[model samples]
Every structure is written in structure tokens, then in C-alpha cells.
Target: MSPEAGTGSPIGGTLPRPRSPATRDLGMRASLLFPDREVAERYYLPLIYTACRTCYSELEPQEIFDRATSGRVTTDKQQDLIRRVIESGHGSTIEHIVFTFAISGVTRTLSHQLVRHRAGVAFDQQSQRYLDYKRPSYMVPGTIADAPVEVRERYLAEMDESLAFYGEMLEAGIPGEDARFVMPNATRTNLIMTANLRSLIHMSGLRLCTMAQWEIRRLFQLIRHEIFTVSPFLGSFLAPKCVPLGYCDEDRNRDEHCPIRPHKDNVLAAWAEKRAAAKAKGREVPTL
Candidate 1:
């Protein structure tokens, strides 16, 4: 359960928006499509340079893109300078380098957590209303599937019942939107996501949190896997939110378990302890 959204509760009226479930690249590759390594190595930095410069310089956007994409500007220099600004949280520079993933086999439950990102990311999911599936499927979590055989059977039975009901609802001339009310959280879907580096980091932070739902966390695992395929350097940035933030803010982490990173409270406590120790030496630590 995601404490961020009040215990990963049923999305219900809280998330009124409907989205297409994307599921094209689950076990598949996100690399075989747009912005191949050649393009990324060549025009990517320049394209970003153009985007960043357009807002500041008198030159036209295409001219900037040309300067960056063409041999007029060097790629390493552009990337090096962009890294500094990105580190400083000057996010606009990253809006230029968008990665599109051919995402597949994720559930509607995960998608709700996904589309909450409002800035610098765009998603187009496959429509449920139009996709009259010959065979609609759902996922079974390992915990549930690995349960007692009868329990697993009961779980799958519920999923099958839900899918069967969805089809029956459609046959009864029910609207897809309302008919989808019968769909299980396990229903598989696909999407294509284009996110700037900043939003990508932000989403990775939340979804990668130990307290986040397993489905969304697994989706990020897939995203990281996809990123790793293209460039390990870039993939290095895709990690649990705490890896970059230096502390875990997820409320569920107050237990101090999941020790990949220290809880934010523990960090504060350590700082306080260190500050008291410094005061014993008659030197007070200055507030930032």
C-alpha cells in the first residue's frame, strides 16, 4: 500500500480519470524502437541544447536543434553541462531528452499510480473500450499464486469470474467505462511512455520506494531493465528514490526495515546526535 495516496486504497472517486492499459514491452525490448543509440549519441544532446536554448536565446528553435544535432556543437560538452543543471534541479534542460518505452503487461492498478505524474511525461495507453479482446487476462501475484493450491485456485477463479463478467457486461450493451468496473486489478494492459529525465527520476523515487505497491514497483523494475538495455550510464540514475534522496520518506519505513537507505527520521536523529556531540566540544553546528 502506498501511504502517499492514503494506503494504496481503491482508486475509486479519488482517481476519476480513465487510462489505456499499456502492455507491449513486458518481457519485450524497448530498445528496438525510436531514438536508437545512434540518434541518442548524435542528435540527443543537441536536441536538448536546442530546447534549453530556445527559451533563453534569440535564435529560433529549429536553429538550436540544428546547432545541437549538427556538428556545430559537441555531444559530450552538451551532456556534461546539462548534467550540472539537472543536478541543481533545473529540470527544463531534461525536458528535451524524452525516452519512449513500449510498455506492456502492467495492470490498471499500476497505471493509476503511473498517470499521477502531471509534468514532462506523456502516456498513450491501449483503449479498453475499443479492444474487444479474444482473451482478456489478469496477473497473479507470487504471494497469492504461491499460496495453498486451493487459495491460488480461488484467486484465479475470481480473476476468471471477473473477466467473464466483463465480457458478459459488454454483451449486455454495457459501456466499457462502467463495464471496466468489473475488471480486476490484474487485467493486463500496455502503454507507450515518454518522460523527461526529471519526471523519470521523480516517478522512480515514488514507485521504487519499499512501501510502494508491488505491481508499480515491478513496473519500475521493468523500466529500469529497459533503460539498462540502452545505456548503463543513464540506467544508473534509475534507482530506488532513496538512493538519490539520501533518506527514505515513505511513512511505512518508520519501522527502519528495508535498509537499502536510512529512514529520513533516522538521518535527522543522527544529525541531532552529531550536533550534540559537537556542542560537547563547545562548537555549535550552524544551521543551513
Candidate 2:
């Protein structure tokens, strides 16, 4: 009997489930392609230092950059000033240096979400309209792959049928652009992503959150690992925003399901209680 036909079994009546933690290999890759560690260590920090120090120093930008790169200003001093400037919300200082990544094998679903970040970042994605895929690849979510054997086989068969139909369309003199209309969100693609340090940090803050979609969250994890390999100092800044803010702001996290940080509402409620106690003691407490 066809799996889709009711078989009077409990599994046949089950609803589709969310993606699970069944450890399916996603085959995603994020490689840092520009500014190796030595180059980044020598020039990247100096560049940002020049941008920041220009506000406080009489020296020309060139002079400051030369001083920073030539070690007239120690690395410690440069990093110290850069850290202070960044923590002070002076993001323009960090916008001077950029990192480039060669990202591959990610699903269209992940790429769609990734390209939503527009500020200080650029992307060149593989064009389905231009490249006629002779043998297209795709991703399968863990939940689908780990479902009951009959259900899993049925899902695979559907994916195979879709791709086969796409190929048949291409062979029947259909344009690649039109043929690609049949591709699923699981279709894999590549891209080149470039972003300034500030934008990378901002992107990471949201993508690295526990509440983020698993695939994109994993992609950011790889991105963070790549950054850490080159410059741990810069990578240190790539973390969930709540780590710095001390409270999670995600609406879905109000129930505190993923406890990477306390929910903002709970934190505010605690603060209100503290303030009430202080007011009762005739000592006024400052509001956050």
C-alpha cells in the first residue's frame, strides 16, 4: 500500500513534526578566504585603530596607521583602545576592516534568511537561472530523515521525483530559469559573503542565538569558528546579543525554554521588586 494512503496505523495518523536533533549531516561549509591571520593581525587592527584614534589624536590617519602597524603603539594599547571604542557604541570605527567568506552547500532556505542582512554586507549567490544543474543536490532535515521508515522512504521518493521532473523539464527545451522553479527550499547552493567587522558581529549576535533556526544557527557557528581561527580577539565579539545585554529579548523565549540567558521580562520584574523594596525603605533607586 502507498504510504500516503491510510493504513489504519498510529504512524499514519501522526502529524508532521518539527526538525529534530537527530544529527543529520548538513554538508555546509564556511571558509574565510581573505586576510589570513598574519595579515589581519598586522593590518586589520591597525586600520581600525587609525579610524578610532583619529578622533583623539592630532596625527594624520596615515601617521596613526603607521604608528600602529610599526609597533610605535603596542598591540595591547591598540586593542585596549579599540575595545573601549567598540563597547562605547562607536561602531563606525570597526567598519574599516572587512572579512570575506566562501560559503557552500547551504540550502536555499538558509541562504534566503542569510541575505536578509543588508547593512555593511554583500553577497554573490550562485544563480540558478544561469547555471543549469546537471545533478542538483539537496538537504534533508533530520526530522524527515529520522521519521518512521515508511514515512522517511516516502519523503525521499517525493524529493527524487521532484528532481527527476526538473531534469525532464530541462531536457524538454525548458530554460534553466523556468526549470529551477521546481526546486525545493532544500536545494543546495553556494555564495560569496563579505561583511565589515561591525556587520559580522551584528549578524552573529542574532544568528548565534539559541532560538535561531538550526541550520542558520549552525552556519553562524561555522562562521564564528572561522573568525576565531584567524583572530580570537575579533571572534570574541561574535556571540549571542543576550550575552552582552544580560537578558534574552526574543518573544519566543519569554517562557525561558532555551536558557542561554534570563528572559527580559523576568529581569524587569525582579528589578521592579527590588525598586519597590528600596522605596519602602525610604531610599530611592535609579530606574534602568
Candidate 3:
């Protein structure tokens, strides 16, 4: 649980709409393949609400789940409790639910970063070692695509040459495990990732930020959309870290150029001013 969660403040109050990049058709996709909308609507909330309710209720877990799922507890009440428990930094309550995504056509560069998250998450990626490529496609970043004609042409030609050589190596009886050494980071791959709610929110906080790599940020954007389609309430929790922190912490944003939130320095400066004013009035305020 984040320190900000202990404040019991709703971080999703006004999440800036994620930027819609022009990379939509670039062969990338994130589909929530499990826990479809019906399941999410019927079981997900009840499960989380039951977990939260179990903490302070005398009712048995089974009875609580039954009441929640049977509509004995109204949806609004369940959501309200969930919102409060989550905002109260009781993260384990929400870990009972999980989401699985079928992610495809992202670059190796992005997949490398994606798999680094190890807690409360599981992933099985397409194996480059077992599969042989036939007309394998690669990604051309917006920067490279929009470069001068000669630079763009050279980039494409280099990619084509690399794949052509990979094919020749395979035909010459090189194992894919050995031949994939030539595959550029731009080569596309697929993965199936399942993460509990807590881990999903944590990953989203890091990956959905403006300071994140553009391709991976776009991937999380697509993932956030998938979560939104199934349950907007759950999706609301997916946001950049600064949203929850109520200030930006990235050193790159020290200049406060991104504007999503004030820098931590500025927030602390304001806090100090308030504290000093209270002291001058012969009163003291609690320290952060």
C-alpha cells in the first residue's frame, strides 16, 4: 500500500485522460481474456467486498460473500466500502481478485521491461527459442518512422537485412536459439500476464507515467482500457504514481514541466509555509 493511500483520499478524483497515441494500429493489442464483464460484475466486487467486510464483521466469510453476491448488500454500499478500504491502504483486501491479459505484438524492448515485475504476477511469453520466424515483422518507432527519408530508409533496410540474415542462418541449420542472437530488440513478441489487483495497480503506477518509455506506456494504456471495459471502478485505480502521491517525484519532472501534478519540492514548500504560519499563531501542526 502506498503512503498516500493512508490519507484515505480518493486518488482517482480527476485522473487526466490518458493520451491517445497514433500507435493503435501498430500491431499491439491487450485483451482481458479472463474474468469477462459478467464475472467481473457478479463475482469480483463481491469477493473484494467480502474480504474487506471480513476484517470488521462478525459474519463468517462464506456468509459475507453470500450476502454480497446475492445483492443483500447493495452495489453502492459494496463499492463505497471497497473505496474506503482501498483508500485506507488496506491493499490485501483487493488482492483476492485478479486479471489476465493476452498481450500481443509488442516489441522485445517493451516485453523485457514488462516481465521485470515479479510479485503477485505471472507471465508466459512467446518463446523465441522454440519458434522459427517466417516473414517476421518488426516495429518501427515513431521517431524512426518520422525521421528524414534517408534515415528512415536506412532503418528499414537494416531491419530487413537483419531478418534476411536470420532466415539464411536458420536455413543453414542454425538452431533458433542460436540464430535469434541476430533478432533486434524491435522484433515483436507476445505474452500472457495474470496479476492480482494490487500488483496491477503497482505496475500501472510505474508504467503509465509520462516519464516511462513511450512504447511500454502505450501498452499500459491499452491494458488500462481493457480493465476499464470490464469494470470502470477497478480501472479508476490504474493511474500514474503522481496521481496517488498528489505530487510528482520523478527527477526528470523537477522542473515541473509535465504539469500533471506539482513537484514534491513545491508541495513540501507549501507545507512548510503552512506549518510556519501555524507556529507563529502559537499553535503546532503534526509533521509529515
Candidate 4:
């Protein structure tokens, strides 16, 4: 495991770094569709293991992967190569390892943001027109879920009404394609997303941000859990943007309510303070 995986501790540990209350574990059955655990250990890591090795070794990448996966090369050597390549930000090597997910029970609103990633990923969403859901379900946001009974009842009623209207339209001889237009953003969806290691990290950085929509953020939380089940080392990369960046950059984080990490503004402020102190002592801080 990497020593520097999770975000660091703040002044008071009381602040909640808790995972989203809206998220739940549906298991890795939804996430590990591309390479199984044994396959990943035997081939995927070794593929990246080879990619990293080829940069330094006299041998070719194909040769390296063959040896590494076949147990000719030691696991330590493979991991050491992977570690250096990753730390140096040679992302192409890590891109060789991909993950396939059978994402289910997430909202259409979440799926919209997920599919926006145009690089190193592919997605095939369940067609609302073709797959007329016999039993549709929806996820209520934590804020709404915790609301008073009257408010919660009203919210659920509105969602029910929207789905009812879609069914009614379909029953009234409207085509499924046209009927789907009445479906609300609250409606659940399923998808198959296959993303390379680098893309997964990039997507996790964005979706796990405090600025991201709550529903999509929750989906990422679930996805991360699935990855953790198979491989903690690989799964550790799927953390919030601030965790990897060492500071939060979201515009809304200026107020610092989230408190997972110090905001970028805080880091800059500390740097400026140190510079001023140095200037007072007749020393100059070097500029980039």
C-alpha cells in the first residue's frame, strides 16, 4: 500500500470526512466487469508492470509483461517500476490497466455527468426507450431523505406522479421513445463504463469534488468501494480531487465548509505570510 494515499489530517479531527450518506454498497458485481481480481493480478498489473519496465529495461514491453505475468519477474520489481512511473506522472503506462463497471441504480442526472468524460473511456447506457422498466426505482438525496415526513412524502409523490405519467403515456399508444420524454431526472439508470486507469483517476478527481452534483458524487463513492474489494492498492487512487491535489480548488470551497482539506486559497495565504515574514527579515523569497 502507498504510504501517502488518503488526504491528510486537519487541526481538529472532529470534522466529518465521512463518505456521502446518499451512497450505498451494491457490491463489485456492478464494477468489476472488465478484468476479474485474479486476471487483474495476473495480467493487468503486469501489463502496466511491463509498460513501466520497458522505459528502463533493455527488453520490450511485450517481453516484460510476458515474464512478469508468467512469474519470471518478481512482484517487487514490477511494483517498483509501477510506483516510479506513476509518481513521475507517466500516465500512459497506467492507462494500460482498465476497469469495466456494470453501473446500476443510479439516477439519469448522475449518468449525464459521467458520460461527459471524452477521453480513454466508453459507456453504453441502458436505453430508456428500448428498456421499458417494469419496476422503476429512484434515489432520494440525503437532504431530502432527512426532511420532515410531510416534505419527504411530497417529494416521493411528485416522483411517483412523473413515472405514472410515463406509464400512462405508453399505455395510451405513445411510442416508448416519446413516452420516455416524461421520465424525470430522478429515474434510476444502468450503464457499462470501461475506463483506463488514468481516466478512472481523472473522473474520480472530478466527480468526488465537493462542487460536483450530489448524485454523481455518490455514484463514485459506490464505485470506489467496489474497487477496494478486489485491490486496495489500485482502489486507493480513487479519492477526492483535493486528496490528490493536497488542497481544494473548487470555487465553493473558499468558505471552507467541507473541511476535507485546506483550500488552495489557504495554501496561498500561508505562502504569502511566510514571504512577508522573510521580507521583514531583509530576505527575498524566490519567485517562479
Between prediction 2 and prediction 4, the one with superior TM-score is 2
Provide the lowest-lDDT 10-residue window in model 1.
1-10
| Strongest candidate by TM-score | 3
Task: State the lDDT of candidate 2 residue by residue for 235-266, as single tens digits.
Answer: 99999989878899999999998888999999
Can you write out model 4's per-residue Cα lDDT over 244-277, one digit (the tens) per residue?
A: 6789998888999889899999999998999999
Candidate 2 deviant stretches above 4 angstroms: 1-24, 285-288
The Cα local distance difference test for each model comes to 0.69, 0.85, 0.85, 0.75
lDDT of 3 by residue, 1-288 (tens): 000101122232232333444333566889999889999999999999999999999999999999999999999999999999987889999889999999988889999999999999999999999999876778876555545667666877888888888999999999999998988898888999999999999999999988998889988899899999999999999999899878999999999988999999999899889889999999957765
What local lDDT does model 4 show for residue 55?
A: 79
What candidate 1 gets wrong by more than 4 Å, as runs, is: 1-32, 48-79, 172-178
User: Where in model 3 is the C-alpha error above 4 Å?
Assistant: 1-24, 285-288
TM-score of each: 0.76, 0.90, 0.91, 0.84
Ranking, lDDT, top scorer first: 3, 2, 4, 1
Q: Supply the global lDDT for candidate 2.
A: 0.85
Count of clashing pairs, candidate 2: 0
- Candidate 1: lDDT of 32? 26
State the displacement of the C-alpha of residue 249, model 4, in Å, after optimal TM-score superposition: 1.1
Worst 10 residues of 4 by lDDT: 1-10
lDDT of 1 by residue, 113-133 (tens): 888889888889988877766
**Residue 99 of model 1, lDDT score:** 82
